[model samples]
Target chain A: MNNAANIAVDIAIILVLIAGISRFRTPAGARFGNAMAALALLFAVAVALYRNPMLSSNATLAAFALAASSLAAWRVSAKINMTRIPSLVAFQNGAGGLAALLVAIVEMSGAGPAPGAVASAAAAVSVSLGAATFSGSMIASLKLSGKIRQTPTVVPGHNIALLFLSAACAAAAALLFAPGDPTSALVSLAFLSLAFGALFSIRIGGADMPVLISFLNAATGMAAAFCGIVIQNRLLIACGAVVASSGFILTMVMCRAMNRSLMNIIVGGKAPARPPASSPATASSPELTAAPPAPVAASQPEQPAADPLSLAADALRAAKKLIVIPGYGMAIAQAQSETVALAGMLEQAGTEVKYAVHPVAGRMPGHMHVLLAEADVDYDKLFEMDDINAEFAETDVALIVGACDVVNPAAKEKEGTPISGMPVLNAGDARSVIVCNFDDKPGYSGVPNPLYERPNAILLFGDAKATLASLIAKLK
Target chain B: MSDLLVMLVVFTASSAIGYVMISKVPQRLHTPLMSMTNAISASTIIAALLLFSSKLDSPHKVLAAAAVALAAFNVIGGFTVTGRMLKMFKKQ
Candidate 1:
C-alpha cells in the first residue's frame, strides 16, 4: 500500500507540473492549470495523512495551528493592493525560506549532536541558505513597500564584512561535519546567514529590484530543495527544483534586459558616472543624432516651450498612426485606465493605436502589461520593445505617457550613462513626441533624459492619470 | 537506484523540464508565471506534515509544529494569491 501511495504521489506531482506549463498556452489553459494545482494540493495532503504514523494529541494541535496561520496569510494576500504585488511576492518567498530553515533545525535537533556526515552537511547548507533567503527577501519587501529607502545602503568595508560572514558560515558547516556537538555552530550559522542576507539585500538599489527579487526567489527554492534532501522528502525536491531553475532563467532575462552583469547587481554599487556635458563634444554618432531637430522660430524666445496640451491635441487630431508608451510613472499615478481611454478615443477617430512596452518598464517584470490588461486594453494591440521599435518612424504621434528611462535618447548618444547599452524604444523617431510627465526628473537610474530637450517633444506637466483624462476629454 | 541517486535524477530532470516549460511563457504573463511557481514551491508542506507526525522529543515537537505552520501558510497563501491574480487576466 505504501509503495502504491508513493507512486500515486509522484504521478500527481507530474500532473501538476504539466498543468503549470499548460497555463502559458492559453487563457482557458490558465484556468484549467489553476484547478489542476488545487487538485494536486489535495492529493499531496491526502497522501501525507495516509503515510502519517502518529495521530497523537500533539499532531492534532499542530494541525490546528497550521490551519489558523495559513488562513490568516491567505486573507492578507487576497486583500493586498495590485501595485504592491512585488512586495507580496518577496514576503511569500521569505516565508518559504523560513519554513525551510525551521525544517532543517528540527531535523538536526531530532538527529541529536552526532548526526551522520551527509545529514549534518545537508542541514548546515539548508539552514544557512534558508535563513539568508528569509532575511534578504524581508528587506526587499520593506524597500518595495517604501517602509525602507530604496537606495543602496553600503556599509564601509561591505566586501570585507561579507567575506567574514561567508567564512563564519563555512566554519560552522565544517564543525557540523566533524563528530561533535553542533548546536552552537548551528546557531552561529543561522545568525551569520540572517546578517548576510540583510547586508547583501540592502546594498542593492531600487533599479535592480526585479533582478534581486528573482535571484532571491531562486535562492529560497534551492534552500527548500536542500531541506528536502536532509529530510528525504521527494515532493519538495521536485517542486523546489522546478522553482529554482525557472527563477534562475528569469534572473538571467532581467539582467540581459538591463545589459548589466549579474555579479555587479549582487555586489551593489552606483553605476559609472556619465561624462560631463561640458567636455569637448564627441562627434554624435549618426544614429544618435538621427532624430530631426525640433524647428526653432527665430522670433520666439531662446528656448520656446510649447503649450503641451494644445500641442498634444493638435498632433492627435492629425495623427494617422499613434503609439502609446508607458512606464513606472504610469503605475505610480494609476494612469493605465486613462491611457487606455485615450487609445480608444484615438482609434475611434480613424487612427490606428498601439502600445509599446519595455520588458522591465515598471516595478516588476510584466507590470505594464497587467495594468493595461486590467483596463481592458486589447492584448493584440500591445507590442514588446523589439517588435515596436521599427514602427516608430512611420508613427505620426508617439504619445509618451509618464515614461522616461525607456524612451530617453541618452542610451544612444552617450557612453558610461547608467542605461547605456540597454535596449530602448525609438520614441524619438516619431514625427511628433508628446510627453505626459509632471517634471523633467531623471528616472530610477538617475540619468537625465535628453528626449525632453528635443525640439519635436512637447512636455505636459501634471499627474499622469489626470493629464491623460484631460487629453481624452479634449480629444472627444 | 539508491534513494539519494534517485532524488538527484529527479532533481536534474525536473529542473531541465522546468526551464524549457517556463521559457515558453510570454513576457506579458511573467507575473502570473512567478505566482504560479510560488504555489508549487509550497509543496514542501508535505515534508513539514511528515515531520510533525514522526516521533520526536518535546523541543523537536514544538519546532516541528512551527515548520508545519510556516509551510501550510506558504501553500494556502501562495495558491490563493495565484488564483486571484490569474482571475484578473481575463480577456475583455
Candidate 2:
C-alpha cells in the first residue's frame, strides 16, 4: 500500500485499539479487543514498512528489530505481576521516548539547513523532551523494579542546578542553530541535556514511580508528536497524539488510585506517609498453614445454631439495607452473576442493595469493578470507599463476598501494621457483616483483620459461587 | 550501531536482574534501586547526545538531544523525590 492507504489503515487500527482500551475504569471486553487490535497493528506495520523502498532494502534487519522490540514488550506485559507493573509501564514509556528521540535525530541530522526555522525549533524540542522522558522512564522502571533504593540520590542545590541546566540548554539550542559554529553549540546542548535527565530522575521515591511512569508516558507521546511534525509524518502524528491523550488519561487515573497529584509526583515530592512496617509478632498466622475455619467467627461474634436454610431465611427477612463488597476471590470464583442474582432477590424483597468498592481491594486495580461490570452491574450503584463508609451505619447487612483487606479494620485500629494507613471499607459498622471466603488467610498486605471478630460479623465460609447461588435460591 | 546494541543488551540484562531482586529486597531499598536505574538511563542519554554531534544539522540530532534532556529530568527529579519519601520512613 502507498502512504495515504497506509495512513488510513494505521488510523483505523489505532481507533479500534483506542476504543478497546477507552473504558479504563471498568473491566469489559476491551482487553480482548486491545489484544486483537495489537495484532492488527503488527500486520499494518509489516505491510507499511515492507512496502516502503527504504525500509524494504534492509527488510531482514528491519524485521528483526521490530520483532525484538515487540517480543520485549510482550514479555514484560505477560510476566509483570502487580508489584512489577509500574516498572513494565515505565519501560514501555521509555521505549516510546526512545522511538521519538530516534525520529527527531533522523530528521534533524539529515535535513537541509533551510528546512525552516520552525522545523528546527520543533526538532530541538522533540530531541530534548524525548531524551528526558526516555531517561526518566528508565529510572522510574528501575526504581519500581527494585533495582535501586526508593530514596533521593541527589547532591545539594538540585533545583538551582536544574534551573541553570535549563537555561544552558536553551542558550545552547539557540547558538547551535545560529549563523556561527552550530556543531559546537549543539554538542554542548547534548551534554547539558544528559546532565539534566540524570539529575531529574535520581531524586524521586519508589512509591511514586507509578504516577511518574504515567507522566513520563505522556511526555514521551508529546515528544513523538513533535518529532512527527518535524518530519511531516501524518501516521506518526496520529499515533503520538493517541498515546499522549491516553497516557494523560491513565496518569490521571493512577493519581486517583494513589490519592496524589501529577505535579506533586513530577516535582519530586514525598508520599503523605510511609507504609507501616510489618508487625513481626502478628505477621505470620497459623491460618496460612492449617485448615481454614468455617463460616462462624472464632472470636467475638457468636454463631447462631441455625442451619443454612434458616440463616438464609433470617437474612432475607431481616435485611432492610444490604451492601455487597466484592473482591479478587469473587473474580476467582466467578460468583458475580450469582451475587447479582442474590442482590436482585434481596431488592425484590424490599432490601436496599448497593456495592462498596475499596480502592486497592483486588489482585489488580478495578478487579471487582471488572467482575461486576461483567454481571451487568449498574455503574452508579458502585460506591467508592469514602462514599460507602458512611452508609455502613444504617446498613442492615453487609455481605462481604470474598473480600479481605479492604474491609479489614486493621487499617485504622492496628498501629504499625503493613496497611495501617491505607483506607478500608467500614463493613464492621453495619448491623450485620457476613464474610464469604474459602480461607481465613489475610490478603496481599498480610494483615489479619479485626473485622472478623466484630460482634455481628459472620464468616460464611464456603465456595463463594455455591453460597451465593444457594442464597439466591433461598431468597427466591 | 554497535554502541546502541551494547546499550540495549545492558538494559535488557539490568531489567532481568531487577526482576530477580524485587521479591528479595526490603521495601526500603526501592528508592535507591530506582535512582541507580535513573543513572543508567542518563548514560543512554549521554550516548545518544554524543551521536547527535556527529549527525550535525541532520534530523537525527534532534532525537539525540531529546533523549539527553529526558534522561536528565529522570535522574535529577527522581533523586529529590526519593529523598523526600525516605524522610517519612526516617521520621517514624
Candidate 3:
C-alpha cells in the first residue's frame, strides 16, 4: 500500500472521531457520538491490520485476549450502579495507561531500528508518564470506590518530595541515551515517575478530586500520544492526541468551576482550617452585615425545631417554584430516587420544580446529572449552576438534599478560607431554604455555612434518603 | 526524518481540532464524554496489534498480547458504559 492512501484513510478516520466528540453537546447526541467514536476506533484497528497483517498464531492469541477482557468489562459495567461510575472510569484509565507503558517498553527495548535522539526521548518520557498515570489512577480508583480512606494524607515534606522526584525522573530520562545500555536509566525513570505520581495525587483533598481525576485523564492521554510517536503510528498519534485535548479541556472546566488554579489543587496550597464559628463581624457579604448575630440565628430553627419537617413540608406545599440542589452527599446516602420522587410530587402539586446542579457537586464533573438521570428525572428539568443561580431569588423554595458546600453562601462570600473564591449555587437567594443535609456541619471544604443560620431556612438534618422519603410522604 | 515531521503535524492538527470540537460538551454529558475519550485513548490497541504483525520473540509477544487485552477492555468497556449512562438521560 502506498503512503498516500494510508494517510487518506487515517484522515478520514480522524474526522469521524472528531464528529463523534462534537455530538456530546446533549445526552441523546452523546449516545450516538459514543458509538461513532467506537466505530472510528474499529476502523483504526482494521487499517492497522491491513497495513501489517498479523501472524496466524499471534492473531489467535490476540483475539482470545481481546474477547476475554472485553467480556469482563461488559459484565462489570452492565451491573455497576451510577454511583460507582467514577471509580470504574478511573480503573479503566489505569488500564489504558498500563497498555501505553507496556507498548513503550517493548518499543524502547530495540523493537525497531536503533531509535534516534528524539524518538528515544519520546519513548523514555512515555514510559515514565505511563507508569505514573497507572499508579495514580489506581490510587484515585481506590479512594473513589471506598476501598481506601478518602482523605488527603499529607506526607511530611510532600511538595518538596514531589519536586525532587520530578527532577530525578527528568534527569534519568535525559541520561537514557547517555549510558551504552539505557535499561538502568529507563527503569529508574519509571520508578521515580511512579513515586511522583502517587505523591502528587495522595495529598489532594477530597474537595479537589474532580480536578485531580480530570488531570490524570489528561496525563494518560499524553503518555499514549508519546508512545505513538515512538511507534510512528499516525492513527495512534491522532487518537491519543484527541483524548489528551478532551481531558485537558475537562480539567480546565472543573478547575474554573471551583475557582481554583490546577496548581492550588495538586500542590495542596489551600488549607482546610476551620473558620471561627459565628463571626458575624467578619461576614463578607455587605447585606449580611445588618443581620443580628448568634441568638436569632441559632434559635431560628429551634422555635419550630420540634416540627422542622412540617415547616419544610408547609414551605414546599406553598411554593409555586422550587429548585433542588444535589451534592455528592446525596449519592453517598443513596437519596437520588427519593429526591427525584419528591420533585415529581411537587411538580404534580402545581409547583414548578427544577434541579440546580453545581458543576463540582459530585465526585466527578457532571456526576450529579447522571445520578439524577438514573432516577429518571427529565433532562429538561435539570439546570446548570450558571443557568439557575439567578432564578433562585424568584423561586419560593430551594430544596437542598445531602448537599452543603455548593449551597454554602460562605464559599462565594468569604475570603482567606479554603473555599474562598469558589462559585457556589445561590440556594441562599431563594425566598425560603430547606436543608436536608445530614447535619448543620460544614461540607467537604470545612468552611462554615452561613446559610444554615438564615432565619427563613428550615434545617431537616438526617440521612437524606430517609429525610427525603418523609418529606415525600408528607407532601403526598 | 521527514516522516517524523509529518507525524508531529498529525498530532498537533488532531489535538487542535478535537479541542474545538469537544469544548462544547455540556456539563450534563461531562461524565459520558470523559468515558468516551477514555475509550479513544485505547487506540494504543492498534499499536499493540501491530506488534503481533511482526515476528516478535515469545516474551515480546506476551507483552503485546497483554497490551491488546488492556486496550480492548478500555475501549469496549468505556463505550458500553458511556452508552448506558447516556441512555439514562431522559426528556420529560
Native interface contacts kept by each candidate, as a fraction? 0.60, 0.03, 0.88
Best by DockQ: 3
Candidate 2 chain A weakest ten by summed lDDT: A22-31
Q: Give every collision pair in model 3.
A: none
Off by over 4 Å in 2: A1-28, A39-52, A55-57, A75-83, A111-114, A151-155, A179-199, A254-260, A271-391, A394-476, B1-92
Give the CA lDDT, 0 to 100, for residue A365 in model 2.
Answer: 33
Q: Model 1 clash tally? A: 1
Which lDDT tens digits does candidate 3 get at residues B1-92? Answer: 78778888988998999888888878999999888999888888888888887677788888888998998888889999999999999987
**Candidate 3, residue A127: CA error in Å?**
0.6
Each candidate structure's TM-score, on Cα atoms with residue i matched to residue i, is 0.91, 0.54, 0.93
The sequence of per-residue lDDT tens digits that candidate 3 reaches over residues A1-476 is: 33787779988998898988998888888889989999999998998898789888788998998899999989888888889999999999989988888887776664456667877888887888788988898899999998987777888898789889888888988887874666677778878878887887777657677887888888888888888888788888889899899889999999898888787777754466444553552343333322323333455565633466777887899999999999988998999999988988888889999999999988888999999999999999999988989999899999998888888888768777777788899999898898888766678777878887787777777789998889888887
Report lDDT (Cα) of residue A195, candidate 1: 97
Question: For residues A200-314, what per-residue lDDT tens digits would candidate 1 score against the true structure?
Answer: 8998866688888888888877887787788666667777888898789888888898888899778746575333542332333222232233353322455355345656787
Model 1 scores what on Cα lDDT?
Answer: 0.78
lDDT of each: 0.78, 0.55, 0.84
**Cα lDDT over the full model 3:** 0.84
The per-residue C-alpha lDDT of model 2 at residue A217 equals: 57
Error of 3 at A392 (Å): 0.8
